[model samples]
Target: MSTPLSATFRAILMRDIRLAWSQGGTGTMALSFFMIAVTLFAFGVGPEPQVLARIAAGVIWVVALLACLLSLDRLYQADYEDGSLDDLALSPLGLTGVAAAKILAHWLATVVPLILIAPLLGMFMNLAPEGYGILLLSLLVGTPALSLIGSIGAALTVSVRRGGVLMALLVLPLYIPTLIFGVGAVDAAMGMVGSSANLALLGAVTLVALAIGPFASAAALRLALE
Candidate 1:
């Protein structure tokens, strides 16, 4: 019998989280990398608070996007290496369901932490309090789309040698729209330019990704598996 949707989702999420935890440094490494990247920008641009505050939205979004990218290679590579991916393929749950759960797990593991850590990073960048809230909110809506779209790349390159570099190349172009709207929302909110339009665009992109990402990822996984 097929697994119930709720159970399958929960199981998949748990499995991914457990795996991530076992990796023993994924979160710490990604977080440290994010902090370092932000710090580099701070130093590189000089310590002008006005300039930092003005650029804070872009800095946070860019760092978070890069942080997420740092972890995407492991999204499916670990499972594929260990033979669990084969079992998942043979399981009763549809690949789309698996893909959705994996994307959710990726968001939980990567993006959620980025949101929680962002305010601290924002302080370093001299982000306004109001802009911090906008940054968090935009990331909440935007990063999942990153994970979803990234899953397709992960699946496509899972079996290839040197897949990580290829995955970055494939995924980065696709990430531009999300990055634009995400930072735009923050900028709009901070500038009193009205963030609703940017927020709406981000939501539309996310909704489209939610509907299509799973099927696309599943297809890629099937092709890789074959």
Candidate 2:
């Protein structure tokens, strides 16, 4: 009897999640990078509360974006190298589904931890009290787009040697809108200018990424396999 497609998807998702949480995995590295980068920024800018408060949202958002980028290089590299990607492509879930699973797993394993920690970093940066909720909300809504949009770059460079830099070059330009609205949302909250519109726009960006990323990533994966 053939395995169910839903089961295959679940198995793939669970497998990736477990791999991500293993020692020396992307989750650990990304989280550590996020913490260290934020701490370094706080130190470099000195201890002026006003200065830290003024730059808090942008700094945290930029660091979170970089953290997401740090993990994208490995998104497809291991499977491609081990021949698991070919088997995945042949499965009932297909390449697009595979890409989707990886995207979700990446978001859950990597970005979620960053989102959880952002408030603590915000406190270190002297982020205003009002901005904390908006910070969490923005990251929750915005970071999925990072994973979704990043998967395309990951797929495009999966077969390249040391493609992490190339993937950054490809995706960094694409990340600006997300970074913009993300910071805008938090800034609006801090300024009391109403963050609802910014959050809505951020959600729109994620929606667009959701609509396009998996298909684009699957196409790239198919090309890489050929």
Q: Give RMSD (Å) of candidate 1 vs. truth.
A: 1.3
**Residue-wise lDDT of candidate 2 within 46-98, one digit each (tens)?**
99999999999999999999999999889999999999899999999989999
Error of 2 at 52 (Å): 0.6
Which stretches of model 2 miss by more than 4 angstroms? none
Listed per model in order, the count of residue pairs whose N, CA or C atoms clash below 3 Å is 0, 0
**Any runs in candidate 1 off by more than 4 Å, and if so which?**
1-3
Locate the minimum summed-lDDT window of 10 residues in model 2: 4-13
- Which lDDT values do the candidates have, in the order given? 0.87, 0.94
Which ten contiguous residues of candidate 1 have the minimum total lDDT? 18-27
Clashing pairs in 2: none
Please report the candidate that would top lDDT against the real structure.
2
